[model samples]
Target: MAKTFKYAWLSKLSASSSALLFHYFPLRNLGYAAREFAKQGLKPGELAIISKEAVAPYERPALSKAYLFPESPARLPGFHVCVGSGGERLLPEWYNEKGIELILSTEIVKADLAAKSLTSAGGETFSYQILLIATGSTVIRLSDFGVEGADAKNIFYLREVDDADKLYEAIKAKKNGKAVVVGGGYIGLELSAVLRLNNLDVTMVYPEPWCMPRLFTSGIAAFYEGYYAKKGVNIIKGTVAVGFTANSDGEVKEVKLKDGRVLEADIVVVGVGGRPQTALFKGQVEEEKGGIKTDASFKTSVPNVYAVGDVATFPLKLYNELRRVEHVDHSRKSAEQAAKAIKAAEEGKTVEEYDYLPYFYSRSFELSWQFYGDNVGDTVLFGDSSPESSKPKFGSYWIKDGKVVGAFLESGTPEENQAIAKVARVQPPVQDVDQLASEGLSFASKI
Candidate 1:
């Protein structure tokens, strides 16, 4: 719950005002910067660390991939990964000597804004000159979805370490080896791919017409559905799992669909969606659609207290309410800005406003993809997929008010996305990109 700060674990030192880091890595890109602050001359006691997870800050994405394929864990970029055998271990060797307090197994229940103090699940209270609230989100379970035998042996949500562990065990133990993953969202499809990799008979069910229906256009969504089906995963669309019935052994054996057909299965993975972990901060924070509302600096209606990661939902200058991100990258970006604002205010300097482009990256099978800016809404297409044939790449830009608002470049590093981001981060340019494309000029050059 409430522990002390230690800093010898830091690979290097910054020494600014000791900071209290919340959540685990990669979001701690904030703490990485805090070390830079330390070298600039802040004291060792100026830093503190806290996390609710019992292990090192590992990537949640892996739970859906690598845990099923042992070799996948070895392929991660060092700086981009997290988690110790237990959880996010900032590592005693890294910061123990710096006097930055390390508190694990503790939960920061609420931020007492005016009092400059925080309350924790341990019932212990601590005061902070400055604080960071990096509490994240939780998976939306299918228990309330009229799913019978919801607690049956194989019904699970793929979110936390335990969830991943359960899924791995279920896949490994299924002697008949028939696995069903409910919902066709990003997490669902990715996890389905993981199960298929192990040669398991995997089937994914979604109520929509295509996979990733909420994110991509119908054409793109169809491409994905076909792509996964080709890889040996049976995708059942336009149907919902209205009711389920299991065997006497409390095992999930049959899934009944609204179409009045029953499909047999050995296990099921649920990834319908997720909601913010706002119960702890419920009445104390301003919220809409169940997420914290914050301004540029992540400042809540209450002062000196800030919220980041999945729990906070703020306006994006470029997308308006159009952007409500819950990705790992968005969390880190927002936390870094929030941390800097805290640091500047400490030195009696004017805080720099927080403004950033929203982005998300995921590997679907062998394809590596990254998206920036508004990938949805009033979309426009550019380039030709016919050049590559079987694995064609698509390029398109999102327009608003006659300006290039956001762009999506499937495949590659989304170099065009990076270019348009500079302009999209503030406001859409007045230039007419559609006209430019009509003249045979590439979107990259126009940006």
Candidate 2:
């Protein structure tokens, strides 16, 4: 006889892709945009978000800053601990209050491009006159190096709430008090800075010789690297995590590095990168490992279906090509595009291409850095190289054929940033650094 088992699941809703619908994680900024759409009294339709993390999409920046607040000591809490229920994300009840319909806790299993419909895991089907898919990303996990106990409690990944909490608790309780961060990418550096500020002995290992090789220039990276080193964070460059050793109780005791040096640690936090969730996507949408390719209008190769967020590697007018971005702004912008397309299509209008500037922000040791667009071309920089705080705290540059690409400066100064960003975009002819600096926005005035 089969043993009795019991479980409960949330109720489900289905929608026609043609209906006015929106999709996104409940608590994320995407919720703000969706609430805007609901202002139109959109017809309730099938909307879904396949978030791999259990928590509603709360702000991720808090994961590292939570302990600093006076409210609580550093402790490892599960992903959902901070995020309010579906309420935090504006769940169906919220939609009902706003006269909008949203379907949550349901995963979309397949998209019927020909029929303009999507299927849920429970076999529920929604034919979309319009649809939006906003499931975001899963963190790229570390591979065990086959060393015994490499998978033990001392090792942790920081993708979800549980991951950050576990690492935080472990770091606080360490006897010898050592921590090793295996990557110097955006997430890794952020966590490493937090750990160092907390008075923990932290060693951050970076494969690339410089910090943020993908985002910042060598000059800026060198400055930040030195700054971090001065703050007691052992900066390890061009190295890798090779192995781990267990204590007498079988818990991981040390992290062995490729340089034959072992970092005695209470815990190891790995923050490599993140990728879109397409592992189970078997639909007929033209796709790549990066994500499903959407046209300028956010439509996929499949007719009647559109993809958004980290999953849709959509086209960019600025890049003049297709690109996949992982920024939080990209998610909001992409969702808005798909929403506009749906709203217009329901009214029988032609679709327009979605063009958006990529933006992301990070905090490192009291310094605030933000990027407006991808400035992958030649870079010209202006700033005092000295790490001392008394100097001017602004750096501006021209990227991509002298297009205003980026700027880093003290926070709470939006007007100055806007002016510099305007100059960066003008592609102003530069006779010399002094000339460009003294007379700003000669080119911008033309626009």
Candidate 3:
């Protein structure tokens, strides 16, 4: 179901509040900000987080990874916030113990930045001196593309715990049935593998030529494509699902392709992409690159207003450009940085601005891959990509201005991944492309 935002005002809280945060999702960013605010000696009941989800902040990345495991999917409290960062999990009790009010299942129906006020769907209003907006992103649906039969009962989109729960139940109910995974991105690929593991005949469909076209080169995509093929996952590229045929029960029964092909499908899952949720503050704040524009400190145009997570398009100090990162690492780090900046401002102290390097990773079956830094410049593929190899270990390096600016590795050890990050940060000069490709991991290790 889609959520519609409406603006209305009926009641208002006393204008005695000090700080407030509004996040549409139960994001780890809120938990991180709460902990940082406590560390800064902010008193209990001084800050609050208004969330649209009833659950506490939890690890979202696991929703695609361990949360889909057929045997024992990850449950609540296990993947709670801060736990994913190797810190103590912040449960509901933890928030209460810290005196931070977590107003869950509330939607901000109206936002008045000039007056520093927010009115919830219940007509309750809250005022604040400082505000943090971490609205996150919304998944793009097939309805957005005008695809037919999107209202089918068996079709799904993975975004929240509720969505995941529905998919999990469907997986159990549709065992040994056919599945069609729409899109070739991380969610599509990972979900296809998990569905296959659940004993479903999965067929991945994407309009792109290969998986992860935004980052993965053709050579790198080939490895994973072949691997999925070996696992009995049919990949249909260069075509898209134009419509769907549903049974009398309103369940999707077949997928219609553009190339005059129709495939049977017991279930359908779509993961095209996401759009940053910043419409609530469209004219209230500066906007850029499809997100709320923020400074290096994550401060927005409005005084005492800061934006973080997927909705913040802040300066990428490493790349000398403004970019909005949708990954979890940036979400957590930006929240912590913004909290620190707010604390410092109150105390008349200065904190360092955020300087983040891009990092992304995904895991499926027995394969895991990690990428670091900007993927610009000439590409150099290295290591072994052959499926026949006992251990398929391979990587790629991006050379720019005769220096290594980015890297990617599949099945890399902890230290090896760390080395690649360092190489990206330092950007060591490469004397020769052939020699650099030949050296591969050795070059990063030396860096």
Candidate 4:
């Protein structure tokens, strides 16, 4: 099956003097980049190769969402690149049809930026005139922090398709069991909700006072915390998982906390966070904030080498600072912009610099929230947050310099969400804090 899929994506090749290479994971960014380059009239023999460590390019985000559902699990070709962006799915056959090479399960261990070459773990060297690095990020594991019993059988840290499979199987095998979710980020939150829905008694443990401390304000966290509690999920905040105890079969039995509380657990899921996969080019490239440093065009210091997705820390033109965005939206746009820039450079033409607006969203249970722009300045939370509200609706506007710079909403209508996005884009001024808070979605609608 794997061999057939690989060859099905193999197209006619030619002896080209130069080639374009993409070293990435199963991310849509590289797919978009390849599509963009082809759209730019890349010659047939130019040689476009996409090498990935995964056996097939599938959706990574679904590993925490649809893949967890016991009834209908997401499978291959369904969640491939572009589909998530409302475009045609790029299956293995799609690559072959385009004459682009699809090199799966090939890990590029070494990259020589100056020489414009890469060395695979299998001792094969690939030379490229242009290289796009979209290796993405790696999930931080309990072993990274010296947490004991992390190697237990039922302990999982999901970052790939295989990891998701193991987690899903565990959920099936241990029905009505206890689950301990470590971390308070999107992964933890989403996984907890799904596990609880699967009949597992889930206990979420995090060191922050509320969930998603990185972005969710205390007011925003309160609603989610209350909602989860209502769903019978045990919340353990302001605490960290220190260790784990495994039974004789090497399955986690209990999770030890910093507060001397040991919670019984049949399964453990960790989502502490992840660091960019930049070690491959550690000294060979410039890095900022633990990610490869790039300009507005996603070009690295080394000529002809462009970095996109989670690996590149490019300048955020909107905020006038350097940032490495992890969201899928930024990854897609950055990859398209970088590919266009590369084509323009080849044609002796110049393109516009990337001017991106930060956007992030997460959906769990019946609730979904989206945030756009920076989360700085005074927060004006509006709408109903009470747990008893039949149709709960609430949002927050970040007021910076008397203007709305960021907005987050829960249960917002489509039009209301668009209004919030517009407010963030325009950074409209707020007349009065009290009025803005009272008006809520109305203020954004007017703007």
Candidate 5:
């Protein structure tokens, strides 16, 4: 005998002894949280996942990475939940096997915290004993800033599957055409490289003096910017896209820069930033740092309700301050923590508090970099960081109060990367800056 899952729009439902998860964007954490529930003694039919996407929970980072590859692009079921973290690939069948109801493409229009009910746009209501909010973040759009002609065709923003599909179609339609990428953040750098790989004439524009200024120091940016330049990407820094011109077909034609330079474009991509999707729970939950504030357990102020992923502003035990991380790594960990806390509470047991070590990484054409811990304080560049190096291998360390507070590595081996991660977590003290630079990866390995 098999159990059938109920669709959200088909009928009203109640789960008096169950947990319900609501998520948008990436649901990798949601998948992990469900697994944790089952592993911690929750029975069949005790959990459900609600998402607006038609597909099951998958690795959202793939949308910008392998998904855009010109050859043999990544597809669903392959990059599904948990795969990004080297876990089992959780397909829709996995949910069925686990008796977890997957309510896909169901948008929850209203939420009643007191009633513990969520109403769908189709007029169906669902009630739950426990709620997990993992709504993630929404991409910031140029239209929000009143950028003229932002509504034109062939101007894309990659956030969801639908957006990626559209961009893929444009890539095929406008092969070997010119592309102007706006904003020099993660999407800007990655997309510029990807477009160039597809043989598109690519140009990157940013208002900052360097790309990825939020994390990359000038020295680190120099290597990447120079590499991009060598790859035939025109780097336009310290300027912004002010407006756009469209053809009669409503396709974007030209990008008007604030510096008074107009770039002819067959396609355009913007990656300014994203905002946490906490608007629905604004008055219902405690918020700090533009995200839903949670404890170390990822439990919100609301009883029996938890928040995770990009929407959560939890205590960074290392820094002793509340912080919101918009990366996939934190999202995955927070989701697991919330699930553990819920199950532990039921059994009158406890789990360890989350003490997260910040990690961020990016991958471009023949280049990959990983950063751990905070990027504040004085930085020391090490190794051959030159863009012209045949085999570029370099790293940087952020020293604060004579302790190695952060580490960034490029072209590092598995053991070397682990060493850097350990250094960041241990916060090893350094007596000589010159020695540390010269020693480079050796210093971290010895730590």
Candidate 6:
């Protein structure tokens, strides 16, 4: 069960100079960071995690995946922090035992970084000597675009547990109804599959020529589009939802497209994209690439303040550039890196700069794909990518300056995925593109 803590006791504990406050608790690595703090000699009541969420940090990605399962869906306490990454499930009791305060259901309305203080929406003020900003990102809403009937019920966007719960309830109520999923990115593909599994007629609409056009090549997208078609998913490309119509009860009923088409939708799931939640500290910190700029240690321009996860645009040592990644892997790793950096600085020591290898993956209805490294340069499609194959297995390689810069594989074994990752990192040279395509998985294996 989830636990709740009252802020009345916070007044007594806010005076410590060692106090470390986490602005939000959506990150799984927050638990790991807190543990690292305790291990580094921080005492009980010295660490506090403040979140607008009602519950402690859980696996946020599951909201669009397993949490929405029609049967045996994942729930709280079961999918808490660290569990998503095969680490310890840090339950609320664990925090209590560790003397870490979980300030749940609290929103920080004002942040005075210079004063090292945070003011909650409930008028509770908490002071901290060090701050870790993990506010993450907020989903881009249709209403933000002035779309009609954007406020209608049964229209959802998944980001937090509360959003997932609402979508799950809608899934049950609108059994066998039509679901129109907007956007063609990660959330769009995953949610569409889940909705279809729940017996809803799924139709995906995107403005791109193909799904996941940012990362997916035409050859790669063809397989998925074909597979989704076989699974009865309607793919409407090159258009977008211009507006939405609602029923008498204000539930979304129809989605009007820009290409002169209208789709009947009992439920609408919008996943266009998200913007980093950095407005709270806007102008107070250096900003770049739409995120708070930070050093290798995740330290912001201000002293004793750090930004991690989706909000931190830090140096990607691997690529020698400043970039911000919104994936869970980066979030988990960046948080831990910041914790270590903080502790090391406290001890007058230093930690190595973050060297990240970009990694991404997704799973749906027995289909899984993993990509590693940068997806730049020319591509080579390999193996049997045919959707109708009895056992479809295929991949692609991105060659930049005659060296493999990136690798993507579908339906790969654990060992195979690791091999591709190594290939991306090592970036082995290729003598010929056709030979590389023919080699496929073996090319990575030999590397």
Best by lDDT: 5
lDDT string for model 2 (302-332, tens) is 6556667777887788657788888766765
TM-score of each: 0.82, 0.79, 0.95, 0.94, 0.96, 0.95
Candidate 1 local lDDT, 1-447, one digit each (tens): 443332211100111112555442233433443444444455667666565544433456666767667344422233223232222334444455655555555556554546655556677655565555665666777676646667777888876566677777777788448888889987888888888877778889988878886666676565567777778888888887876678898888988788887888888888888776666556776786567788877766766666666767776764456245788777656765766666677778766565667776667676555556665446655444342246656655566666655655566544555665554554445466566445321545454
Q: What tens digits encode model 4's per-residue C-alpha lDDT throughout 1-447? A: 111111111100111112455545435666776677678876654645545445435557788888898677787767887777788788877766776666666666766668665666676566677777777777898898788878888999987778888999999999999999999999999999999889899999999999999999999999999999998899999999988999999899999999999999999999999877777678888898888899989889988777888888998888889998998788788878987898888779989989998989888888888898889999999999876677788999999999999999898777888888998999998879999999989888888
Give each model's whole-structure lDDT: 0.61, 0.58, 0.83, 0.78, 0.84, 0.83
| Residue lDDT tens for model 5, 1-447 | 212222111111211112476664456767777767767776667777877777777888888888989999998878988887898888888888887788777776777778777777677667777788888888899999999999999999987788999999999999999999999999999999999999999999999999999999999999999999999999999999999999999999999999999999999999999988777677999899998889999888988778888888999999999999989899888888888888888889889999999999988999999999999999999999888989999999999999999999999998999999999999999999999999999999888
For candidate 3, lDDT tens digit of each residue in 67-114? Answer: 889888799989988997899889889878877777776777777889
- Give the root-mean-square deviation of each candidate in angstroms: 5.5, 6.2, 4.3, 4.3, 3.5, 3.9
Weakest 10 consecutive residues of candidate 3 by summed lDDT: 7-16
Clashing pairs in 3: none
TM-score of 3: 0.95
Best by TM-score: 5
What is the Cα root-mean-square deviation between model 4 and the actual structure?
4.3
Q: By summed lDDT, which 10 consecutive residues of candidate 1 come out lowest? A: 8-17
Error of 3 at 315 (Å): 1.0
Count of clashing residue pairs in every prediction: 43, 17, 0, 0, 0, 0
Pick out the ten consecutive residues of candidate 4 with the lowest summed lDDT. Answer: 7-16
Candidate 2 segments whose C-alpha is farther than 4 A from its true place: 1-33, 44-55, 67-93, 99-130, 144-149, 248-250, 350-352, 390-392, 402-404, 410-412, 433-447
| lDDT winner, 1 or 2 | 1
| Model 1: lDDT to the true structure | 0.61
Alpha-carbon runs more than 4 Å astray in model 5: 1-18
Residue 220, candidate 2: C-alpha displacement in angstroms: 0.3
